[model samples]
Target: MAKFKLFKDRKGKADQAKNNKFVKLGREIYVQARKGGPNPDANFGLKTAIHNARQINMPVDNIERAIKKASGNGENVEYDEIYYEGYGPGGVAIMVKCLTDNRNRTAADVRSIFNKRGGNMGESGCVAYMFDQKGILIIDREKFADLDEDILMMQSIESGADDIVTNEDSFEVLTHPHEFESVKSAMEAAKFEFSSSEVSWIPQNMVGVEGENAEKLLKMMDAFEDNDDVQDVYTNFEISDEEMARLG
Candidate 1:
């Protein structure tokens, strides 16, 4: 199985990075609620938004405030979902997801970042072809110290998961996008707690990056995540664990 790279925080920035994630999640909840009513039970998008927010440990008060702002008649700030494809250092394919109130501003900002950071933004569907959307559920090892990996794997497979990848500190259950909900429900029914869960873009291949290119790419990623309009950024860059430690 290929080890795909997902967006992650760089060393020494975990605190600010997590807070940034909460802001993005709050925006997502507000957008989803405004688009599909505030009721999570009735609105699938809103429900998923709330789930993602909770996955990141977003505060309950913040979640409720976003929903309230969306449902109430007071504030009206419509956000548009936009995706930008690009190439970062070492020719690694990149995909940026954004929720913005202004298309032109977001596009300009994204393009500028790409231009200045050893990258080039491309048209829609440019690098999107290199990725497939998949659902991932991560279970922490310490959370269930007595859990058997084999039994958990068997249960996940029976529950519709396609595969289970064991990492040093966690178990990652993979599922087809269509079967994600059923598998998640089954695991929940089995009392399995998830460290994190999401339907995300997975790269088809990995492109190795090192030295200056790796540094440049990491900076580019940080730039995108720091943008208020940007939500998520995905890439196919593969940096060795050793290189990552050195970079840190």
Candidate 2:
């Protein structure tokens, strides 16, 4: 829920970022484990959460502890999934997905952040229409430079990916939500390593924000990410390099 920095630029903040990621992943794992069951094989959601945590290099001990806690008394935890919609500076559509045991507290916090950042919180369906849920698989381009792109693309397609594209830094595979796991499994079987895999709500079109607008938007996002209950944040805003430089 911050400025979209390319992965290569995160070395300085990688440790903190990783720690935050662990907390988010642990919450997700705990929720899934409690709701479905602690056994990954028997619970699809738990299995997926574990897979996601592993992708981020979360420690095995940490992962197991989350499940153990869930198996013990996590069922008593009454977390509610809430979606907050808002418009950021420059009218950028935003969606904040949260899982909190205290709805009133989360709502107040989210509303305050939005207000402080010069945005207005809206009803649930306000901005969701502008995004589409899709599965994304990303691989480091430099790591797979020796592979045959045509074959890799072909294989990915044969394995149920919707499309594969190569950018300067990474190779991205797009898939329908339901086909995500199968495609990832096929890629793994074919010895392809992924940098990330997730089901995300991607914006249909990007709205540009600059100067004050960009600053406010990023601040609002940071506030959301800082909240333990806020799981994911999505926005349809794009900032220019010049604006990002000024922000930095």
Candidate 3:
């Protein structure tokens, strides 16, 4: 198995730092509600999105307003979910998930970024084959010091988890997409303080990039993440701790 690079702790903060999270959260809520209904109680994805927003300290009023706009008579922004695959610098496979009302606009924007950044957008399924869809659960390490790794491993295995990784400050539980909710519930019932849990694309392998090329790739990813139409961006580029500290 490839060593899972801990990007969440560093990249997550940088990615969501620009006050764009709320807009992204609103868009996700709108789409999830449109797909299932306004009630978070009935929609798992919506509930998860709401949970994520709350974890990030998003205002309650903003969350309520998003739900209301999604359910009530409002300017219905019909967003279509799309994924773009590509290769970034150093042959790193990249996957860009987007929710856009206008495909043309989104495509042009993404294409321009790739072109300028020494990357190119790929055909459907071109780069997706290098990744797998998995349920990822992240828990704060400080709150679970009493929980033995052996016990957690057994619980995860029983819950159909594929893997468990303990980093310096977090526990990452990976499971099949179908077993995500069950494992999440199990951890919650055990009183673990989860920072976030969701299904995401995990790269099967990583490409190591360093120095200026690494910096450029990171900037490209940042630009893509800043786009309102983009929902999530996954890449196989691995940055060393030295690079991360410098970037931070």
Candidate whose lDDT is highest? 1
Indicate whether candidate 1 or candidate 2 has the larger lDDT: 1
- In model 1, the clashing pairs are none
Query: On residues 155-205, what C-alpha lDDT tens digit does candidate 3 reach at each position?
Result: 778767899988898889998999888888776777655788788998887
Give the least accurate 10-residue stretch of model 1, judged by summed lDDT.
Answer: 1-10
lDDT of 1 at 57: 84
- Local distance difference test, per candidate? 0.84, 0.81, 0.80
Local accuracy of candidate 1 as per-residue lDDT tens digits, 33-76:
99889999888678777887887789999999999889885588
Q: Work out how many backbone clashes candidate 2 has.
A: 0
In model 2, the runs with Cα more than 4 Å from the true position are 1-14, 73-75
The TM-score of predicted model 1 comes to 0.90
lDDT, residue 143, model 1: 79
On a 0 to 1 TM-score scale, where does candidate 2 land against the true structure?
0.88
**Candidate 1: where are CA atoms >4 Å away?**
1-11
Would you list the clashing residue pairs of candidate 2?
none
Q: After superposition, how far is residue 59 of candidate 3 from its true place, in Å?
A: 0.7
